[model samples]
Target: MKLVLKDYIESLKEEGELDSLLTDLLWSVGIKIFTRPNKGTRQYGVDIAAYGKNFQNSIEDQNKEVFLITVKKGNFDRNNWDSGKNSIRQSLNDIIDVYIPNRLGKQYNNCKINIVVASNGELSEGVIDNWVSYTKEQGTKNDKLNFVFWGIRDLVQLTEDNLLSELLFPEDHRLLLRKTLSFLDLPDYDLRHFYELNEKLFQKCLPLKNNRKLIKNLRLLRLISNILLKGCVEMNNIKPAIIASERVLILYWDWFKKRNSFNEKEPIKELISYHFFKIQINRIYFAKVQTSYYSEDGLSFGIGNLLEYSLITYEQIGISATIGMSELYEAMVHFPSDPNYSETCYKNAMQVSQSLGELIFNNPASCYPKYDEHCIEINLAMILFYQTERFDIAIQWLEKLISYLRDNYLLKEFIPLFITDYEKLIQIEVGGYKEEISSSILITCLADWCIMLKEDNLYKNLIELIEQSLPNIDLQHWHPEENTEENLFNSNAMRETGSTRSSIKLPKNPIEYEMEMVEERNIFFDETKFLHNNKGFQHIEYLANRHFRTYVFPNSWRQLLNTRFCFNKP
Candidate 1:
């Protein structure tokens, strides 16, 4: 598949194909471009002019010499062979005679000029030999002039080395996917091939720029994961799915290590955030696969291997947030089978939870508070304790969560209003509530836990706190300006949604309205501000359903309903 794609790209005759590819190839190898092929001109026979610094220092420090590149695309078949050679000679002549003289008198007199002639196909043996001899002779005549050649094979090798081949030849990727599927039936299976394939797949999906770039890369990542997961599922075997997911974790860990090698001046939060989401997808895949299909033995082996690898990743990469997630995964995996070990796992998780909160969420230097990590950690603690029937520990985590929410002013503003609107919509369908329920989800969860423990005093105090806070939560700040972009989106969502609820409108089928809301509400302090409101509702909904499912199903609560579907079903 790789060879076929390389050949196809080599055969391309479209204008700018060779130039753009050469640009990418040079850029990947740390050549800093001064100018490249301009829109409508041949760029003085120099396809790309760049500083070809020594390879090691090229990326790390400044370059002192210039390299002028000339790229051509053609075979040496009789008709055009002379033209191709002549084109190269002219490009070299331009660099040595005109281009260097023009630049040297101004800014680069002492610097050397290196001529690179890159072509899509090889010259005949005699032609290359003669060309090299003449090029070296010319170099001797001009003390600072040196030259080199990059044939199709060299370019392909460069592309592969830097993991940029997929972007250069996207069609090759599509073809490779087909080829991968075909190899599934082979007697000798190579998991390393699958691993390498996923490494490229993930590299293509990484932001490679900033946090905003991740907004789109995330969707691409999901699309890729879905395709891979779907393919594994179609095999009617869990092993392939597990193998793919294992490879994902390994690659993701390597990405984390690589990010560390980057200069500390770079903003690392976005890269860490990217890793957060990547781990999130892996966690979800494992949860789904475990519940849906895998045998107990398979599940144990895969998750155990994953958890062990995660520990090593934590030690090597030293990202506490990732380790926090690994512990949470460990807890979840231990829950159904090893009840005793589950508690131990959750305890380990809670410690990292605290450390992560202190190091990231509480650090003022952090642009976005690691609220997603906070939520995951807090929820894991809540679920772990609640499952173990430790009401006191569950309440502690719940209180801690409410305090976390209170620290973030935006969440404090949005959660109550969102919950109030949600509850009012609920009452309009059913009857009004017997009591005035407070609009905070954590408060509600605490109330449930308090009642379960028969702590009537604590439950009553919590209710009082919620009732007082709900009225104080100013909804005015929550509403965007009437004519602003935010309000325009809200208006559009309201008009387009066929929702029965009179409070807040559900998004249009596209749900861009929700994205707009997320954008408006996304404080840098918490990148998950968009998700927190939705996830808060989800947690409450899950707890409500769980409450009903348990021995504590009360007559008063019997009519309270669950609207969301569960993904944890067997």
Candidate 2:
């Protein structure tokens, strides 16, 4: 009763008598519409052209003045037909001026214009009224115009006259007729053929129901049928493109389930999840590219590489791992602590991570063109070293990263030297550097290093600088708006404060610090000298206090100053 598109199409392909039965039904209807005698030949420009009946009316005559009937086959609202009237009228004009005039001579301009519309269900009163109005208008304006409409009730009445029964043959043959009729795009026929065929098939194959191969084949057939039907309906409506794509995926899943039998449910579930996950990842990648965080040209290489690794390495390794057999153990580290884990899942996750890393860091030219290669190279080296827990190497890499940031003038256009390591720093470029700090990476890196070194003061200084910089740095500010926040905070304080504060917490392992106060906003540091003058400190404190006083409570500035400078700390 509520058949999906696939089901309707599959019903047409049924074997046994059902298939033949349906073909006969359609053929009979075709004959009735095309071969009737003494009917006025007029090209109504209907979707279907049928002509027959008299010997004098050959196929050529049918081609010229055949009944141009539009068949609306499914559960469409009658209003749709009413709305389509204007389009139908245009189609009629095209038939008369473009198609019929040349062949029948201009003298046949008075030829009959018969418009017939057939539907599978009854037309609503509103649709009928609209149709009546259109017909009356056409007839009064042009005496040659005529129309005829048929509903499902009319077809049923004809069937009761034994017309359809006479067309049926053997019992099995009747099933084919039913199937054909069910699949036909006949406006005046119900799905009785499909229902009858399905009933017959189920009865005959009751014993073979449990056959695995049969079941599998049946499922595939069903999936294909659904796809075809859904495609047809979508083509008719032109709105369900996305829905149609989703149905295709569903059909694919069904086919996949039938082809594999490994515990059936688990693999199917995992496959579907993986499919959707890949779609999500692609969406995120596209969104990033659209936002300019990634260049368009880089996307082809990045996405292509990712897909290749995923389909080849990940899938192959995963399959092997699932079976408890994998040679990739030498390449992958597995914790023996977890006994129930599958190596394939872990390997797949690692491969995905690797692919994502490639996309993020591979095309530095497009991603970070203004920065010196040495700067990004060192930063990446530091990231790798940090991940491996080689703290000393990471620190060395960070130093190089810092030196590159300070030296590169174009990089300075987007990022101040001090905040280069913060994660929010990237957002600066992304947000168009209008309101918020152009970068947060410097803060993030500072925090990471301080936390690693167990230096509380360095971490505190980083946090304080971030807080102080928050108000002056508007994330919404962009070019031409005067980079006022650009030179507001002393970068020298930002770079040195992390080490200076860390020294207070680790006096024995004190890190040397030197401050280069180029301006209010730009600062640099020399890590060899663990010294920061009180002059630079006073300037930073002044700006912090001023900002706090104006934006926050005046009393809060004193409290913040005391907290930041250790004036009140025990």
Candidate 3:
């Protein structure tokens, strides 16, 4: 709840970022910004211009109103206050003398021009009076001209009043999380208070169509859900948590479904969909956890309705759509007892996955070829086909993935980069800076599928891929696990430690060395330099390892390595 307004302004990185946040805030409060600050060109002192009718009736007798907002950030002490105030006065002079005359002369002649000075530092009473006096001196006879100052206190107050506390001070999530903990601990849990509080909170957010707020709310809910899920499962009582999660999810679903007013072209829609899908994925995963714990065969098919709306609302947004459908399929695919409804969910997921696969193929770069989302469509399509015993069609899709990877990034040019700069390889695997095929994973996957089908045709492709992959990998210096088929097929073994044969031990105290290599191969190869930015490297490692794990290679394929096979690339 402590608003460090100066620190917040400093965190904005650039004037443009702050302007964007201000724009969203203004738009959320029913103020339509007609012009934005052009950083690439001259802005002429006016950072933004907005117009709206009767904003909370702030101005008396106002049919039309306009707000000219200027933003400045600094410590306005005695040393800098005068210069800062003069600079602002100059901008205001330009706005009143030149901008208003040229831009809004006839249209806003009857409109009240509310000149707002939003500053990160304090504005002393004398400075504020001087600012007001300057405006008054310029518009002595013009009653419609008004000046307002938003210093540190005013901006903090604005954030609180507009329910942007969560977006501004993320520490507010801890408060919400505390509330959830207390609610769960209540001996006689009353749904009434839970529902009431949620309704009130949502009502506060309802008017603000800003996606940032939506994303913040979604993140908060996910965090709470995660905490509740852990608490529920650990206590061996999941009913309360399940109820809470379902209630929150229903609220989110309703709110999300009603958001038809947002412009589709805005990048915020992509962000909104990203958080929205994460929320859905978390909610359904929790539901699955509940189902698994209770052994319940009779949960409602209401999620199908949610997915239907999701598919319609965000079908074009492929990553989330594909991920959502995949999670939905996993959640519903187990209920064989309810053949009709479960089958419906499964079929819907299949259809959506097929469509999403085509979407990715059409624009692979958007999906980021290194991202696991890149392979979700392929994994889903193959799994669905394999489940239905459609071996031939599944083989075709599997072959498509194999060909795609081989043609795209398994070339000599790219393979050597991974060998030389293993860190860049991690980056490539995670879709960091480039869109390249994960040769190791795709080869392993194809080997697994060929073993499953006992098809020599695809098996030959796997051999060729292995030949291509092994050349750059320095077999003499590189450690390979025991030639057991089991090790080869275990994607975790291949991904985490590179081979099941390697082992690493951490020091008793981490600070014994400047840095430590967690992976055995990286340590053996003196690859600590690659981990200069540990967090970024770890993120890449996680995504890369996860991408490798998405599709498992069967143990049956390992025996093929023993044969002296010479086959042309398919």
For model 3, give the 10-residue run with minimal summed lDDT: 532-541
Per-model C-alpha RMSD: 22.6, 27.1, 22.4
Maximum-TM-score candidate: 3
Q: TM-score of each candidate?
A: 0.34, 0.24, 0.39
In model 3, how large is the Cα lDDT of residue 518?
20
Error of model 1, residue 314, in angstroms: 51
TM-score of 3: 0.39
Would you list the rank order by lDDT, best first? Answer: 3, 1, 2
Compute the lDDT of residue 233 as modeled in candidate 3: 50
328-432 per-residue lDDT for model 1 (tens digits): 555665699998777775775565545433332232222111212222223333343433444554455445444544453333232322322435534432463
Model 2, span 49-100: residue lDDT tens: 4433322245555423334455444332454653464344455455445554
lDDT against the true structure, per candidate, is 0.44, 0.34, 0.47
- In model 1, the runs with Cα more than 4 Å from the true position are 56-64, 76-86, 103-105, 164-570
User: Poorest 10 consecutive residues of model 1 by lDDT?
Assistant: 547-556
